[model samples]
Target: LIWAAIHRIESGLNDFESQDIIVGTLGLLFGLIIANLIGLAFARLPIIGAYGPIVFSIVFGYAGMSIAIRKKSEIIALAGNLRLGKSGKDHGSKHKDMEFSGKLLDTSAIIDGRIAEICSTGFLEGPLLVPVFVLEELQLIADSSDLLKRNKGRRGLDILKQMQEDNYIEVRIINDDFDDVQGVDSKLVRLGRKINAKVVTNDYNLNKVAALQGVAVLNINDLANALKPARIPGEHMNVLIVKAGKEENQGVAYLDDGTMIVVEDGQKYIGSTVPVTVTSVLQTSAGRMIFVKIANE
Candidate 1:
């Protein structure tokens, strides 16, 4: 029984790994120290001294431990700040560069057609850098045999033209191209690193790759999802059932901004507009999805 208990404890510790265990142990130690100090203050009381100190110790110790464990991230950050202060060196310039850095527009963001609107809102500052390689990729898509690809490419070009003409934001065409990097996404990452700029893209793959390469990314899809009005259960909205969904008695529709809605028992209502009560909302990396049911039923 003793060996089994030890094995269980070891397994539980393993679930937390190295940093978590260290933080938890430190938290417990700090809690115990605080409890001891508080207990000492109550030790002189005549009537309450006997049990008061003991009770206070236990309560204070547990409270401190729980607080420290819950706020481990904040504690770690505070420790980091203290260590940085002790080093006595200013690193403000490094952070300042990142703060005012230009935004590198990826082909995916341009084609998404929301960046222009976002910029027009005056939220995004600094010059919008459009790499020459991205333009080439857009041209290739525009000349593609696929009709969908051609139209998307044309739309991207139109968006770019509109941004250039808009007086609110500056759009600069960067001539920098990497011969070593074969993929456009890779090139964007490299350019972002070189210029200390953030890559603006809606492509999930590109977003992941840029992050892996230590390049900052501003995903347009993420922005769109964040800007969407919050919907809660029981809220009713009118939606046209466009097509059938994967599940039985389900139909799919889309909002004006392309947020997908899955309606229950809506397959029969296709081609007609009907009221739907929001059952739930699922926000994913790609976009937001609303699960609904027919309002009447």
Candidate 2:
């Protein structure tokens, strides 16, 4: 337990940037001083007088830490105003210089494997950061007892290896990791914030968490969804009716891209490819569905 506590302390120290620590320390000190002064007034209150200073110190100290960390750039800028172009630097820190810092790759993104292709096309420019901790997570998955997970891990490793070998894509191995952050997702988010890089991932929960924490995330699944072409009514295509639809006498087929094709009164056409003319297209929460009839029918 003592060793565990020490490890946690070490991680916390390692995770915090020097600037943040310095600013946060200053804020905490000022907060504590203000709290003690306020506590002196509360000391006159009969019931909780003795504990007022302690309560105020804890509350203000925490508030100070939160505000300092959240507005560290502002504070730094204010300090710079004593000598430099403070406001411009503050604005540009978030917008200008950070834009091209890099894209941090999560383990899931590596496993999905489209990133390498995307990188090859010369569209995704910036350093492709494959963090050491993420690699460790991938290694752990590769060694998992479950065969499916192990296979995925191995595949991810292969994809990463291939990306590294590619000349066009600069796959940078990032050694910076947060030991204090328990999960890989949390660490990834933390690292993204620290480096001011966009996280490249497909995990929905990670996307939400990163957004909530004010870290930009490039979700591959969202990208794929956006890139899916819009299907309109009256489009004709060939599809194979693989099974009966849930509706009466309806045949179910799928396009090569996996969009559902519902064939009207064509249940008997199962196990065969058929030319279908699109009657209508419906967008549902589940996915896109194309309703069609047999060609020329």
Candidate 3:
């Protein structure tokens, strides 16, 4: 009987996430605090009084655990707001929820086209929620008078269709437009909060804005950059300098992945495959740049 109980407890623990554990523990502590306060007042009740503290402890502890686990998302968000208040790091958006939470796709992410590929690769799991407002925006862009916007809009729509056709993928087109929200970006942020989903976007401005509002964001560009090969100082490679860089005595080459390498004083070997040694690497929201000099230099 003892071993079976232990095994059951172990199984229950295995199903809980780390966040759940932390929140549960905190809830238990608060519950114990409240229980002791009440027990102190009731301790003079003779027989019941003798066991008041013990009884209160168990009752409060269980209540706390049940309430905390059920309201985990709200409690977590409240914690985030408190931390943000103290740190003052951001405009103080609420912290991101669990990684496995649903992703709310913005127009930019949909139009970028890479999201479809990323989804197909199985790297991004969970239902992809496309808000009706975002779909309407896509439709507007697709029907635009400008040829460029029209093509991009149509491409985004086609990508959505492609994703929907895949049997294993889950795509949800939700109708949750916050009419009070002034812009699509704002609506996306609002919807993200309402649904506890992360706003998936590649637009830098939207990323910043959504973050400022405490809405979670998953930038496709950020993922692409992280997956690129790391280029550290002193790494050596050979490349044919393709063209002159914007600065003097700077020639440019590119990695097969499209990362730019600026070679110092390498104009002389524009067409020649010369060995080079990396001096430094610069990464930014835009992309990565590697600075190198001729291997012999």
Maximum-lDDT candidate: 3
Say which candidate scores most in TM-score: 3
Ranking by TM-score: 3, 1, 2
Cα lDDT tens digits, model 3, 62-82, are 899878876665565566556
**Candidate 1, 73-144: lDDT as tens digits:** 445545655655555457543432233346889998999898999899999986788988999999999999
Please provide, for model 2 over 1-297, each residue's C-alpha lDDT reduced to its tens digit, 9 standing for 90 to 100. Answer: 999999998898897777778988999998899999999988989877988899999999989887887666446545644433444566564433334347889999999989988888898886687888999999999999999999999999999888878867777675576667799999988877765679999888899999999999888876665567876678877888999999999999987767888999879999988888889987632356789999867
> Per-candidate RMSD vs. true structure?
23.8, 11.2, 13.2
lDDT of each: 0.84, 0.82, 0.84
Question: Global CA lDDT of candidate 1, please?
Answer: 0.84
Better of 1 and 3 by TM-score: 3
The residue ranges of model 3 lying beyond 4 angstroms of the native Cα positions read 1-100
User: Per the 3 Å backbone cut-off, how many clashing residue pairs does candidate 1 have?
Assistant: 0
Cα error, candidate 2, residue 256 (Å):
1.9
Lowest summed lDDT across 10 adjacent residues in model 3 is found at 91-100
How far off is model 2, as Cα RMSD? 11.2
